[model samples]
Target: MFLDRDGTMIDEVGYLDRREDVRWFPWTIDAVRLLNRAGYLVCVVTNQGGIGLGLFDEPFVHGLHAWLDATLHESGAVVDGWFLCPHHPRAVAAEMRGPCACRKPGRGMIDAACARWDIDLTRSWVVGDRDIDVMMAVAVGARGILVRTGHGERDLRKVDLSLPAGTPVVMDLMEATVLILAEGERRT
Candidate 1:
């Protein structure tokens, strides 16, 4: 399964740059544990524009991810990988200020994850809280579930009319996990 980091797994604190600010949602650990136990390769694909904006550096993001991994480990949940795009159109750093394929709505990060992990996009699922998250999944032939957290509810209101029909909308990751697990069982 592919997941969004901010808003989807952890509380969306705008441009989270501090490890002390990390806050997991009530259902995060359990939902991720369920995915791990179910044999799903859970990976995080996030757009960390803050790095480009000069609010934080890549090392900061890595540190925060390390903290996340350690915390999840304590609960017997493992994140297979983390893919982040630190580019933005108006970035403070020239190198990071261009259009990049790894950004959300782009397939670079997802494609890289697939290659590194041998993921089957056809059977994969993505859970996120924004339209771009779903768009990324669609770009790679995966199913998407949009959760109503952080920017989710607002993003839902602004979703393009062209979004795939029947894309599931749920209250949060917990609900999405339940739906995915149930579907997996049904398919089996």
Candidate 2:
């Protein structure tokens, strides 16, 4: 499964550059564990535009992800991979100073994950709280579920009409997990 990091899995903290600023939702670990136990290669694909804007660097993001994994490991929940797009159209950082395909709504991160793991897009799913997150899945024929946490509610007001009719909009990660698991069962 593909998950969005900020907002979708954890609290939306504007630009999380420090580990101390991390605030996970109550059910985040449990939901991730559920997916992990169910044989899903859970990957967190995020758009960390802060790196491009000089708010933070890539090392900080990696370290923070490592810290998160260690914390999540306590509950037997682990993210298989952490992928991010650290680019923006107007980036201050030279390296990040251009739009990249890795950004959400783009397929670079998804492609990177597939290259590293034996992922089948047709059977994959993306759970996030934004329209771009859902569209990420749609780009590859994977299922997209929008969770009503973080920016989900506000962004819900202007979802792309091009998305499939009745694209799932759930309460949170747990709800999305339940729906995904049920769908998996149905498929089998």
Worst 10 residues of 2 by lDDT: 156-165
Q: Evaluate model 1: give its lDDT.
A: 0.91
Candidate 1 residue-wise lDDT, 1-188, digit = tens: 99999999999999998888888998999999999999999999999999999999999999889989999999888999999999988897788987889998898988988788788898899899998888888999999999999789988777463457899999999999999999999998
Candidate 2 wrongly placed segments (more than 4 Å):
159-162
TM-score of predicted structure 1: 0.96
Q: In model 1, where do residues sit more than 4 Å from their true spots?
A: 159-162
> What is the Å distance of residue 30 in model 2 from its true position?
0.6
Error of 1 at 20 (Å): 2.0
Considering summed lDDT, which 10 consecutive residues are worst modelled in model 1?
155-164
Residues 1-188 of candidate 2 have per-residue lDDT tens digits of 99998898899988887788788999999999999989999999999999888889889999899989999999899899999999977897666866678988998999999999989999999998888888899998898999989998888787454556789999999999999999999999
